[model samples]
Target: MTLHPIESGNFKLDGGAMFGVVPKSLWTRTNPADANNMIDMAARCLLIEDGDRLILIDTGMGDKQSEKFFGYYYMWGDHSLDASLAKAGFHRDDITDVFLTHLHFDHCGGCIINNPNGNGYLPAFKNAKFWTNENHWNWAVNPNAREKASFLKENILPMQDSGQLNFIKKTTKDSFQTSSELDFGIFFADGHTEKQMIPRIDYKGKTLVFAADLLPTAGHIPLPYVMGYDTRPLLTLDEKAQFLNEAADHNHYIFLEHDAHNEIITVQHTDKGVRLKDTYTFNQLFK
Candidate 1:
């Protein structure tokens, strides 16, 4: 199996929102903020070429949203999913699966787009079977006030409306499905959002986990540093503690999706609990 780092796009978000209650004095050390207190973030998705199935983990925030909507998040780069796919010798049509970690706009907005010829929205990847768990699907469609803004209808309903949406059955709330059909295991996490699926792939004798929002960046390795966006911040503390401990003990490589600067990171047990051991660029490690 081969892995390609898909550079979806880059944007900046309020550092306070990204780090939650964590003080700016602390988060800025790792993810330094600009004068506006906005920190750089990447919609860095992953493409897995396992046999004929080219699975894309997330699509990033697509370009379909209006300028006013996008202005809220300071977008800053030239990377686009289509352009990145071409760099990897592929296209949207080559993706057999659109594996969404969650239905947040940043993660799945590129899954749908305004119909080029007409008005309504449609699935961007007409051939790909969009993957999202049943619980997450329901949670997204009927979003609560806390998360309603993040789950946009245009980016979501088109898949189900078009009959391409597929659900991965969860054995347990946080169980790891080792025998998944996607040729990789998934650890379903509920802390960030209900049933946010984190994919675990076995590559070259090492376990690489797509650390969706469960572990957004290496700076989040510190136990108390959790995102305010989390509906259940307390649950995240426990989930992160357990996951980071395991990652440290097993020497797993964490593939970060949101961090633009730190592509991949590993954690180790320290007196202060799980702390980042090192960081690696996608090419530095994958090459």
Candidate 2:
């Protein structure tokens, strides 16, 4: 099996919102903010090739929103989903499965695109089955007031409309094996968004986890660095504490999604609890 880190694009977000209640004095040290207080973030996704299946985890924000809509996020960078796929020797049609961590625009917007013929939106990955859990599918479609803005309809509804949407069965267990032969497992987290599925794959004698919004960056390794956007901040604290302890103990490499500078990181159980042990580029891990 081969894993590739796909660089979709970069955007800026308010540092305060990214690191909830955590004082700027602390988080700014790791993710320094610009003069406008917006920090650089990457819409980094992951692509996995195991035999006949080419599975993509998260799609990143697509270039479909109006300029006014995108201005709020401060989208930047030259990277794109199509170019990243080409670099990996693949195309949109090659993806057999799209495992969305959640339906947030930044994470799944690339799933759909405006038709070139001036028609309505269509699935970007025309032949792939879009995978999202039943709980999250419901949560996203009928988004609550707090999260409504993040779950854009154009980025989501088209998949179901195109008859390519498939729901992963809800599992009560912490981890459940996926239908794919890649031996992938889904770990569900509720603090960030209801039933956000974090993919855990056993690759090359090591466990690599797609650390979605649950752990957006290495700076979020601390238990208290929860996002202000989360509906339940207290629940996030508990979830982070439990997940970090296990990840540190098992030496799992976390694939960060929003961290612009750091792609992957491992944690160690320090006196201050779980702290980052080492950082690496995706290629560095294989070497």
Candidate 3:
């Protein structure tokens, strides 16, 4: 199996929102914010080439949204989904699966695009079977006031409408069916979003987990540093603590989705709590 780092691009988000109650002085050390207090975030997705299946983890923020809508995020970078795929010697048609961690615009927006003549939204990956959990789908479609803004309909409805949506109907603890030559597992996390699915893959005798929003960046390794965007901050704290312990115990490498600088990181159990031990890019781990 081969893994490709598909960098869609970088965007800025309020540092305070990203770090929650954590003071600026603390998070700024790792993810320094701009004059606007927004930190650089990467819509870093992963592409797994396993035999006949080429699975894409998540689509970055697509370019279909209106300028006004995108102005808020302040996306800045040359990387694009199409360009990244082209670099990997593939196209949208080559993707057999679109495994969405959740329906947040940044995570799934690139899954849909404007129709040829700008008629309506359409599936970006016409041939790929979009994968999302049933619970998360419902939560996103009928979003509560807290998360309504993040779950954009343009990024989601098209999948089901295109007859390509499939639910990984199983417990959050259910592992990916990697037994028969496929080496991957699905871990469900609810702290960031309801039933956000994090993919765990066996690569080069090491376990690599797609950290999704569960652990957006290495800076979040500190226990109390939770994102203010999360619906239930306390749940996030509990989830992070439990997951960090497991990652540290097993020496797993976390594939960060939003960390612009650090793509992968490993945590160690320190006297205070689980803290980042080393940071590396995804390719470094595979090498």
For model 1 the local lDDT of residue 144 reads 98
Candidates 1 and 3 compared by TM-score, better number: 1
Kindly list the per-residue Cα lDDT of model 1 for residues 1-287, writing each as its tens digit. Answer: 99999999999988999899999999999999999999999899999998879999999999999999999999997999999999999989989999999999999999998998878998889889999988899999999999999999899999999999998877654467763668688887788999888899888777999999998877888988998899999989988888898899999999999999899999999998889899999788868
Q: For candidate 3, lDDT tens digit of each residue in 205-264? A: 998989999899888898789999988889888878878998999999999999999999
lDDT of each: 0.91, 0.90, 0.88
| TM-score of every prediction relative to native | 0.98, 0.96, 0.95
What stretches of model 3 exceed 4 Å from their correct place? Answer: 171-183
Return the lDDT, model 3, position 109: 94
Specify the poorest-scoring 10-residue window by lDDT in model 3: 174-183
Off by over 4 Å in 2: 173-182
* lDDT assessment of candidate 3: 0.88
Ordering by lDDT? 1, 2, 3
Candidate 2 CA-lDDT value: 0.90
* Candidate 2 to truth, TM: 0.96
Off by over 4 Å in 1: none
